[model samples]
Target: MTHAIPVPLPSALVDHHAIDLERKYSDGWGMKVDDVATTPSGEMYTVSKIHRHTYGVDDDEADPARAHFGYSLISKIAPDGTPLATAVSGQSDLARQDTTFGGPTTGLGEDLWWARGLCVLPDGALAATGADDHTHLLTPDLTAVTAHHGMPHWREDDGPRDPFASWISTTPAGRLLCTTGEYGLYNYGDLLDNILAITDEPLTPVSKPTLRALACLEADPVKHTEADLRPGVLFAGEPVGMAHRPRPSLTEQLAKLDPTSRPGDWYNARLGRPAVVREDLFVVPVFGHIYRSGNRGGPFAFVLVTDQGEFTGQLGGMDRYLDSPFTGHALEIAADPARERIYHLNRYGLFAWTGSGDLKQRLDLEDKRFKPLRHFTLLDCTPDGDLVLTHRTQHLLLRIPCPDTLDHVGHAVENALRAYAKERTDLKKQWKPVTWHWVDNTAPVHRL
Candidate 1:
């Protein structure tokens, strides 16, 4: 009996390709790209690590007097994948902890260790939020520091006091949106308490008036007023009833979770990176525990908010996706402005949803083509509608082509042959790789 050849199906096509940014650009020590952003013209900017902290990994004890001495760089990538310029926290000596451009009003240069958030502002500036409770505004070309919005730990600083801008995003017309909270896991309950507009002009100076209007907790005329309860664990000798309060132990807190409990039901509802859908619409993901133990009910996967800081509704939770498990719990999201759709990345796969929260399509991670690009943590969409993804652990970016730009027929055949090669190992040696050729010397055409 003769075996019949499998025909190609359009559904088998994958339009994504991975790029190793770390291998291409690293300053001796292996770098890891943490967060990424894109300009209106498709230029990419990334915050990458130059050194990692050794306190937690090497030893449990942390030195109070000595600085961690970690560093990161911001790079500018042109649309064609060319490295244009790179900016670091310190300019003169890479070993020095002192900053080239940093202050109390702006932020400490050395505070950018493992920078967590990055976004493009309206005036074409770049805003990066660091893991150390500070945000820096850099020039569009990643050259100089234009401004820095530092969320200081103390309540009575010479500078303005703003919420912990843990995560940030920008509106279509130029407003700065932030996920508000205090420092550490003890204050996790306050993580998603408020998703508010922090500033109108992030590139400008962070003034006392500007932060007063954007303050996270209620201000008190009397210092250390116990009445004004706030988030944070009470540290001994620290100012009492100030910005933090005594909380349950971590062990006790973890004990509250039952199998049916949800993230919101317990205590903390940490909001992931924010994605602006339009001038009035934005979405934030509820990033639960790594194991997702308390994700069986309550808080939805993604929360929809208006530009005015109104919570409209939630989408994709365990309860709603009982039939389709992969649709729940997203980590990062990006908006395709041209298509008016949002792309969400979760453990299971990447899902596309319309502005009104309808599912458009889903790309599973288990797919052969997506397997190589599965380790990404950050996601951002370019103006031209392509996705720029950064790996969670590695210094890399995976540029996934938009569906409209993909050659449907070519992709189908290429994947079909790959599947066939796996199925018929005996004939794999005779199979040749697929390549594209110019059909008429004008437009390139792909052929099997």
Candidate 2:
């Protein structure tokens, strides 16, 4: 019996063009342009990094000198790639004790909170998590309104650990729901390493493993009163990294522990996922998984949680076929109000899942230069359904149109492959060799 060879599909989606949104500054190293918002005037505003000057006194304490470094900034850019306005933060002249260099020096540097998240309220308020558990609320014009310093415990002793990520949504009761992730003191030391160390111990089954904090705050938009919005445990368990096990045929359990064991363990633990809000659904991507709930106030549960099966299903059952185990992580999600479509950028590709939980469309551009889906650390869908995506490397902002039809490309490819196979029996006769070629050259190439 001859096995039928499967053909790959062409991505139905095409890039319109890449828009250069930020000017007058370059993206800093490891700086992520997380979120974007539109002002009342229709100008696009983005949260990015900027270089600022910090002053430090000399060894003799004679005079203070200036040093320039990177800091977080909220910038407004025009459609034509012009910077309209910018508001800088997390920079001070005070000398910082540099433990790594073992000296006190004033220098512009990155703040831990900048990596966490930022969001714009419906009433044109800019809310961002700041250093020392400080939540800074600013007007639409970027003016500071109120600052809510987290509890003393959140900022005392070892100093406030920066928030991992934050999400903003309107509750059914007409309040703002702010969700944030806080790193634990013990777990704060190289998150990936600590998690791996715990996993290595066979006797020590992890009990009461606390995650980096995932807290929700309910704040009245008008009154500005804030209260704990989360119910029960925010994130109950610690995230586990991937570990490789030797094939049972190869090694026994005792032999697996040998120092020279074949097929070493593989682990890539990720926690503190980012959150996205679409109408009544609040979605969070954590530990190579996606979880969602309804609104903010009442009881909430997972709409579509991530698992090995779902991950494999999304990749069309190739997870097992590949040599490396498949891993899926959600970077951000975009919702189009006009089309009522939600776009999710996973580690795999850009997928458009329906509001009703149906996988509608997928555009697999994993090999592109500016893999918009892969590079998106922050994403937003405009009222018109256009996507505002921020790249991790370039820190470049992108505005792309979201397709109305979900999974249109996936369906088209499936149909095309079926039709091609049915119509061309000769091609199927040499199925093995021919199918490989077709999948490799799925997109039609016009030779001039």
lDDT of each: 0.47, 0.35
Tens-digit per-residue lDDT, 184-254, candidate 2: 32233221111101111111112211222222211111111122221211333423111211122111221
User: What is candidate 1's CA lDDT for residue 444?
Assistant: 18
**What does candidate 1's lDDT look like per residue over 1-448, in tens digits?**
1111111111101111111223323322234566678788777777665443322332222331222234455667666544566555532223333332222223335456536678887778777785434666666766566555455444433444443455667666666666544433333321222323345554454431132112122221234345333322112323324443223322123334235554444244344666778767777655433344545424335656665445555454223343232333335678875666687665555666777776656555677765544555436777766666654443335565565522242243234334433543432333321221000111111110
Shift in Å, residue 320, candidate 2 = 9.4
Q: What is the lDDT of residue 284 in candidate 1?
A: 62
Q: What's the TM-score of every candidate structure? A: 0.61, 0.49
Clashing pairs in 2: 182-213, 360-406, 360-407, 361-406, 361-407
- What clash count does candidate 1 reach? 0
Best by TM-score: 1
Where is model 1 more than 4 Å wrong at Cα? 1-30, 52-69, 90-108, 131-133, 154-164, 182-194, 198-264, 289-300, 317-330, 392-394, 405-448
Residue 381 CA error for candidate 1 (Å)? 1.2
